[model samples]
Target: MRALQQCLTLAWRSLVQVRHNPWELGDYSIQPILFLVLFLFVFGGAVAGSTEDYLSFILPGVIVMNLVFVTVYVGHGLNSDLTKGVFDRLRALPIPRWAPLAGRILADMVKQVLCILLLLGVGFLLGFRMEAPWWGLPVMIVLLLAFALSFSWVMVLVGVMSRDPEHVQLFGFTALFPVTFVSNAFVPLETLPSWLQTLVALNPVTMLVDSCRGLLSGGPVLGPALGALVWAAIITAIFAPLSVRALNRRLMGQGGAA
Candidate 1:
């Protein structure tokens, strides 16, 4: 119970930082809205025949893409804190060691929820509608967040090993851009070459985008959703322990240096 309280307190602290650093909020707000609008207008006719159709198709993909991109902040912020000695100060407190990580992740989830709603609102104004039942919306959100939580560990590991916050962002986005785009996020798999189709079909981002589309605009739900969950499990299994160990070693090295 006490640990939970500490986690919440640290989460609140992370949230409060946005007020003092207002530009950080723009990453979650302005950037996503721009992506949605630009994609809908630029590729709508060529890809999906109309703005409205493309809106429905791209919105879910945008959400998934944005969610993946946003996880980079976990690494960026953690790397910043580590470099700035904020984690060192937090370590002086009696709170559980995991609480800081949990708190940042919790705060990130809040940001993710806000970003999702913002995109949905813009998507609605742009003529995107949810074809699935109401429950599907919440389920989609849960699935996206669950995947984000698992994936954040990978970034956390990156953050731990990165020399500074800038490197974390550089590496995160450099790697993520290709991974998100090479998949069928913006276009149907059938449009791609047969050779590329098989590989994109295997990309986890394709599964996630397909699952989000199923949950939102109506399509095959179970298979893609299950694939996404399995991918999330595999990622967490591989990266979570590595992140924790790396964090411990980094902190211990810092302590020893002091």
Candidate 2:
């Protein structure tokens, strides 16, 4: 119970810091707007036969990409805190060691939600419509956020291990670029060669995007959603404990060095 309070308090602190460093929100704000505009106009007609037709097909996929990319900031933020001796001071406090990492994840997940909402608002303005009912929007948001929260532990681990924020950002973009672009995010699997089709089908991002597409635009639900849930469970299972241990070790190492 005390730990939960500490975690929430730290989460609030991170959010408060954002207000002071308002430009920290560029990943959540400016980037999504650019992606929506540039991608919608550039690849829309080529892929979907028309700009409007492509908008419906690509908006959900773009949201998934944006969510995944913005999560890279989790690692970068942690790296910054570590470098600035924030974690050193936090370690001296009476709070649990995991609290800061957990708190950061919690706070960043909220940022991811805000990014998604902003993108969706723009998407709606661009003539996107949900064929699914009202409840579907909330359900899709929950699923996407859950995935982001779970995947964030991986970012936390990277942050704890790396000293440079840019290194973490580079690693994240390098890894996520292929995952996002190689799958069904931008184009149909049928459009790709048979060899790549298998990979696209097996991609968790593809499963996630497909589930969101179905929830928003109406299609198969159970299989893709369950697949995505399983992937989330696997990621959280592996990375959460690893991140906790990594942060603890990082704290101990920093203490010893001092």
Candidate 3:
């Protein structure tokens, strides 16, 4: 219980930093809206016959893509704290070792929620409507957050290993671009060649986007949703321990240097 309180306190600290550093918020807000508008207008007609028709298709996808991309901030912020000596100060406290990491992740989940809602609002303004039941929205949020939480562990590992925050962001986005763009996020699966379609079908990003589409607009919900969850499980199982270990090693090295 005490650890949970510490986590919340640290989470609040992270969120409060946004007041002094508003540009961080812009990454979550402006970039996503720009992606939504550009894709919806530029490729909508050629891809889906009209912007209205494409809005439904692309909104959920953009949400997923944006969610994945936004996770880079977790690594960036962690790397910044490490390099800036914030974690060193926190280490003197009696709090649990994991609290800082948990707190940052909790704060990240909050940002994810805000980003999701913002995109949904913009999507609605652009004529996107939810065809699935109201419960689907909440369910989708849970699923997306779950996947994001798991995926952030990968970035957390990156943060612990990288020498600086810039490197973290560079590695994060460089890898994510191909992972996201190669999926069915911006285009339909059938439009691709058979070989590419097969690969994209197996891509976890494709599974995630398909799940989001299922939960929001109406489609085969169970298979894609389950597949996404499986992917999340695999990611968490693999990366969570690795990240924690790397963080501990990095902190120990810093202590030795001091």
Tens digits of per-residue lDDT for model 1, 1-258: 999999999999999999999999888999999999999899999999998888888998899899999899999989989999999999999999999999999999999999999999998888888888889999999999999999899899989999998999999999889989999999999999999999999888899899999888889989998988999999999999999999999999999999
- Tell me the spans in candidate 2 whose CA falls farther than 4 Å from its real position: none
Model 3 weakest 10-residue run by lDDT: 125-134
Q: Tell me the tens digit of each residue's lDDT in model 2 across 113-161.
A: 8888898999999999889988989999999998888778778788778
Where is the poorest 10-residue window by lDDT in model 1?
123-132
The list of candidate 3 runs beyond 4 A from truth reads: none
- Could you give me the TM-score of model 1 versus the true structure? 0.98
Q: List residue ranges in candidate 1 displaced over 4 A.
A: none
Q: List the residue pairs that clash in candidate 3.
A: none
TM-score ranking, best first? 3, 1, 2
What are the per-residue Cα lDDT tens digits for candidate 3 across 159-206?
999999999999999989998999999999999999899899988889
Q: Which candidate comes out best when scored by lDDT? A: 3
lDDT of 2: 0.88
lDDT of 2 at 182: 84
Prediction 2 TM-score vs. true: 0.96
**How many clashes in each structure?**
0, 0, 0
lDDT, candidate 1, equals 0.93
Q: Model 3: number of clashes?
A: 0
